[model samples]
Target: MTIALRRRLLAEFTGTALLVTAVVGSGIMATTLSPDDVGLQLLENSVATAFALGALILIFGPVSGAHLNPVVSVADWFLGRSAGTGLTGRDLAGYVAAQTLGAIGGSILANLMFDLAAVDFAAKDRAAGHLWLGEVVATTGLILLIFALARSGRAPVAPAAVGAYIGAAYWFTSSTSFANPAVTIGRAFTDTFAGISPASVPGFVAAQLVGLAVGICLLTALHPDAGTAADQVVAPTGERDPVLGHRP
Candidate 1:
């Protein structure tokens, strides 16, 4: 593999590990550490989620593009954002695998910390218009937030925006912002406060994908350059990518 590709993979692995650890680890802590206060637990989870993601972006935004969520990648990919140094099937395959493993690691750690057994599998809570709409709206907002952030030369905080979106979505949206397919799947392996049911995975993922598509369309209209596939298509070597600049 080329040095660039190796760097990308390394970034992915490290980012995934941190992302999941923050997510799951915080959840475990919230439950056991502050179960008495529901609001405090949620707050802890939200803050941890935000910082964990933010730190990851700061750590690997340059090397791997810091796309911890596959939905973000898929949205960009479909929008023709993979013009130059974009993901090939090989890159995506490795990314998905790494992300999944990282998520599992997070979930397992959370389980160990919290002594979680199994989930009630709240499928019914997420199977209708409200649920789907929540996904669409939440993900639309999330993707837009990220795309706009990238466009505005603020890739450093991409993780925080993403993390904050998810953290806030837990309360604001009906679906709790399962903004990522890999994350949704990984959450299934653990029977904990963060676990989702396997049965509900299809609807959640589908809704998230729809949200991404809609977000892309909206972004395409708002930012014609990204839509036309002319900007932010590849990692920058000499300078920042036009859409997501290359600066500290």
Candidate 2:
């Protein structure tokens, strides 16, 4: 209801929309430029994802905290880290809705742009089991990286860290590290070379969330940052974020 809350929601929507656009647009391009090799297309996709995320963060860091993922938001909430740019229940709900819708719309746009909406869910280069492992490892790495950067007060430049983690995960993880659920949903709309089947969505989301939980547990084992004062408040809008903020 407040102006700050509105801005925060708008920030969330804007961040999500931009991320989806980059993802879907790149996939469309990859389909054309690298039609013969899917691996090459994926490589292009990872690079684009990293740059898009990094740029978006640099552009939007001062607004809405750039929390484009539900897990990040939930993490912030649980840690009492709500980046009090002025958030309320209604605002949070609107942000979540806008993010999800932005993702879907992004897919549609990509599909329209290059006929990149054709999803061949049956294109079996790898088994579903392997894909599941990819999701697990990719998501875990992302969360752990986020946790480490946030704990270190390096989240102000988190875009770079987040981008590199995702880009690297693409090479290492089986599923190309589609860790963000919002992103996954948006990709689904395209049904293009980057699209995942409706059937894979739920499983991917579940597994990614689980991986994040595992990372959080791991965070507890490490000691708090030595530089920060004992009473340091890395929550809300103090210095950085712990549960939600990304790495940089």
Backbone clashes for every candidate come to 1, 5
Tens-place lDDT digits, model 2, residues 104-181: 766666566675433323232323777777887887676556656666776665778777887888888878888877
| Model 1 quality (TM-score) | 0.80
Task: List candidate 2 stretches off by more than 4 Å.
Answer: 1-3, 81-92, 115-127, 223-248
Question: What's the lDDT of the predicted structure labeled candidate 1?
Answer: 0.68
Model 1 lDDT per residue over 1-248, tens place: 23366667777767776676677678777888987997788788878887777677766765677777777766655665444534666777777777777666666665665666433332333457788888889889987887676566664456566667777887898776768877877677665556677777788889888998899889889976563331332222123455776442
Evaluate candidate 2 by giving its C-alpha RMSD to the native, one decimal: 6.3
Query: For residue 239, what is the lDDT in candidate 2?
Result: 31
Q: Estimate each model's TM-score.
A: 0.80, 0.79
lDDT of model 1 at position 27: 74
